[model samples]
Target: MQVSPVDDSLEQTELRGPRARTRKLMLDTAIALMQKGQTPSISDVAEAAQVSRATAYRYFPSQAALVHAVVDAGLGPILEWHSDSNDAEVRVQDLLKTSMPRILEFEATFKAALKLSLEQWAERQAGTFGDEPPFKRGHRVEMLQKAIAPLKHTLTEFQFQRLAKSLSLVYGLELLLVLKDMWGLEFEETQDIAAWTAGALVRTAIAEAGV
Candidate 1:
């Protein structure tokens, strides 16, 4: 009988189940600790997760590596949002409606991750640290451009920049917090607002361009 290479590899990984589960537990526990603006000591995370210090250290060699894991965990959903839709506008609207709430629900978690990374970045800049910052602003801008490409025909160069800035700003963390916390707007409602807002911005830009 012939076994597929992929399936063979999967079987080997599955056979190492207990060790894999322990690693996942360590990572999850570490992320929970980091979300609270506290980094986990190796012993602390291992004890809390009911794993061993050796196990935790095997997965995350340093505090920076563990912090990077937490940052990736928090941004996982948004990273997956890139594959949601083919059209840029639909993708943005869908992301706004769906991922926004998930992001907001753990806004403090994301904020903590960002703060940790930024502090590390500053330290590196001052030649006191060795780790690189998590995530790049360029990735976000490219994603934004993908979402706005469909509306480009409706905007001039300057107007497109204005529209892009408005969309990014209006749909930011602050506005999201106000809408969800103060106005009590539901996730679905936010999706509607995002779609309508994008459409309005496109129309306005087109009109202004005399197109």
Candidate 2:
């Protein structure tokens, strides 16, 4: 398991044993509150988690940090996804099949994070958010690139990148919402379409690249 940029945001510092557990407890508590239709503050999470405010603050400096942590947690396998195959297309197929469903499973948690992000965006736009870091969302780039590593020599760098970027259209919480909510498809149908669409994109890229 190589070090990922996500690990830094997911951990405030090098956490150990009991401290790691305590941090996880706060994140879990925040997630539970979000699931129940409430956006909890850092103080709120501290109280519900029965941890000291100072300790909770130590783990998560702000509500934004807490929510970002939950969203990243909701991403599950995607953050640390691994595949042994050197076949680019197969790796992507497996990655999407494994991760898309997990994305839907915690849709609400991700959606809440998105909502907070949007609210933060509006505040920033209105010059009220101060110097807070923009609520960043992407954690898929490295894994996606790795999934298609075998294609590196098969296509121009630009073409390979385009294929990987196209995959975002078929994965992630937004895609699930578009399929299940907008298209009104069943879960199986939604996943099937996503997987199918992903395959089509990969095949098309390969074909276009004459590989």
| Candidate topping lDDT | 2
Candidate 2 lDDT over residue span 86-182, tens digit each: 8887999898888877877788888777787888889988989976566777777776788888999998999989988988777777786798889
**TM-score of every candidate:** 0.62, 0.86
Error of 2 at 156 (Å): 1.1
For this target, which candidate reaches the highest TM-score against the unseen true structure? 2
Cα RMSD for predicted model 1:
6.3
Candidate 2 local Cα displacement, residue 92, angstroms: 1.2
Clashing pairs in 2: none
The reply for model 1, stretches above 4 Å from the true place, is 1-8, 11-16, 37-44, 50-54, 82-87, 131-139, 149-166, 170-211
Write candidate 1's Cα lDDT for 78-145 as tens digits: 65555445455566676566566666666766666566667777877888976433433323454456
Residue pairs with colliding backbones in model 1 are: none
